[model samples]
Structures are given as C-alpha cells and as structure tokens.
Target: MGDNDHSHPFFLHHSDHPNLVLVSKKLNGDNYTTWARGIHISLSVKNKLGFITGDIEEPSSSEDPDTHAAWRCCNDMILSWLLHSLKPELVESVLFSTTAQAVWDDLCERFSQSNIPRIFQLNRELATISQGTSFVSAYFTRLKGLWDELASYNEHCTCSYGAKNDRQ
Candidate 1:
C-alpha cells in the first residue's frame, strides 16, 4: 500500500473512500466560493489536490500498465469524491467527465462566474450585521465570514500606489 508514501502524488489511505463527505455543506450552485475553499482544503490534506489541479497527468495506456492503472484508480476515486460533494441535480452534468480535472473545471466554469447579485447581497449583509442577541465571538465570526466572501469577489490592485495605500 502507498498509504505511508508521503512523496507519491497518488497516495491514498485505507480510510479514503468515495462516500466520504469532504465538506459539510454540499455544493448547491450558490455557495461556490466557500464550497471550493472547503473542497480545496480537504483535497490538499488528502494529498490529492494535484488530481483536480491538473498537476498530476494520467499516464498513457502505452506506458507501464501498473502505473496507468494506479492513475486511473486515483482519478476515479477523486471523480467520485467530487460528484458526491455536489447536489443531485448538478451530478448529472459532470458525471461522465473522464478525469478529475475535467469535472473540477466543469464545476468551476458553471458556478464560479462573477455574480453581481451575490456580491451585492454579501455587501448588504456586511453592512447590516450586528451583535443583537448573539455573543461577541459569534457576531465577529459572522462579520468576518461575510467580509472574507466579499473579498473573494474583489480584484486586488497590483500597482505600487495601491500597495502603499493598503499598507497604510
């Protein structure tokens, strides 16, 4: 078993299974940003980020049979994990995708578009958030989450003046 092989990109533990829910919340089309971050963190921890990132390419069938087989096994596991994370309606769209990277790219293209209404909603929530009956920590957490989501939609300026102003 390659479970103990930390250097191998396709290493999988005995417990790693397709039915494992990587993120608590399923991808339902509206929460792509947070859903993507959660999926990314989970896959990174599993040493399978390369499968979705296209960093790990599949071996040609003409290559060593064992190597190609191993790649296919890992890829199918990743594809299953991804499909399991999505809503039932969404699963059909990418169910036939041949590679994990293809499935990931399809989902990203479908849901990660710049949504103006969503950005407006996040900004509104940030502006209206208050402690109310919530504890200070809880209030702060809600506020921070909204800010972070809104920040994800923003484009950071790379100019020297922008950098200087940000530091200030």
Candidate 2:
C-alpha cells in the first residue's frame, strides 16, 4: 500500500519491553488480559518483525481487567517486543499504532529519527495501496472490516500482480 500519506510517528527503544511487562503485571488485576489487544498485534507480525518468532501471551479465558492501564503497558511492551524480536530485515521499518494517545506519545519518545522511517512513509502510501482492486487487494477490501478490523494491520497490501504486469 503506497498511496496513503498520513503517518503518525512515535519513538521506541529495545530495552523497555520487560520493564513495561513487570510494571503492568504488578498493577493489574487480570495481568495478561490487560494487554490482550497489543499482544494480538504482536502475534500477527511475529514473523514479519523477525526476532519475536513466537508470542508471549495473556489468558484468553479470564475476566476482563478493571481498567485499561495494563493494555497501555502492553502497547509499550509490544514495541520492545517487536524491536527485539524482528529479524534484521524488518527491524528498521516496524511501525506501531493504537487508538490511544498515550501510547503514541510513548513511541515518539523512544525511537531515534533513523530507526523506522519506512513505517511513517508506509502510512502515507497506504491510501494509494487501498485504491487498488487486484484479486488479492480485493480480498483485503472484502475482509477489511469483517475480520478483526483490517486497519490494525497497516503493513498488509494488495498482492503483487504477476509477470504479465511486469515492467520491461
């Protein structure tokens, strides 16, 4: 997706993950579930980010938390998790998002200017990518609002059309 042009960037560092996790656990009644949404994102891009080949999860069967503070912490952890987990290839361009403003501010504070510029660029490119209706992109359009809010997966785009479309 290369046409969209609205990117909201924040900063992140590699060391914040475990500290966030521990702090999140201490204050929350339902420790893991508090961070469930962020964990979901982590699980989806586990391979894309590389270093995090697997999930460090929350209990799906438990009661909901009393507040969203745990989720806030989870979002922070997800960044650390991705930075530490991504394979070298994707590490330079990983993007973080959430509806929450606090999380956004946290990100802006952590990453250096050089770490993930591609992520910001990708958001700007997304509107264009969203316009394509290729077979695969069509599939995404069909699924966008149906399967767990497609907006959550910002990096996904229409699949490349094969050799017939190739430039000479």
Q: For this target, which candidate reaches the highest lDDT against the unseen true structure?
A: 1
**60-119 per-residue lDDT for model 2 (tens digits):** 334645224443354455555534433344334444443222222232233212223433
Off by over 4 Å in 2: 1-66, 95-168
Question: lDDT scores for all predictions?
Answer: 0.78, 0.34
> Model 2: which ten-residue window has the lowest total lDDT?
159-168
Per-residue lDDT tens digits for candidate 1, residues 9-98, read: 777778888898999999999887778888888988888888887788888888678888888999999889899999999999999999
Candidate 1 residue runs with Cα over 4 Å from true position: 1-3, 124-143, 154-168
Q: Give Cα distance to truth, residue 155, candidate 1, Å.
A: 8.7
What clash count goes with each model?
0, 22
Checking candidate 1 for backbone clashes, the offending pairs are none
How does model 1 fare in lDDT?
0.78
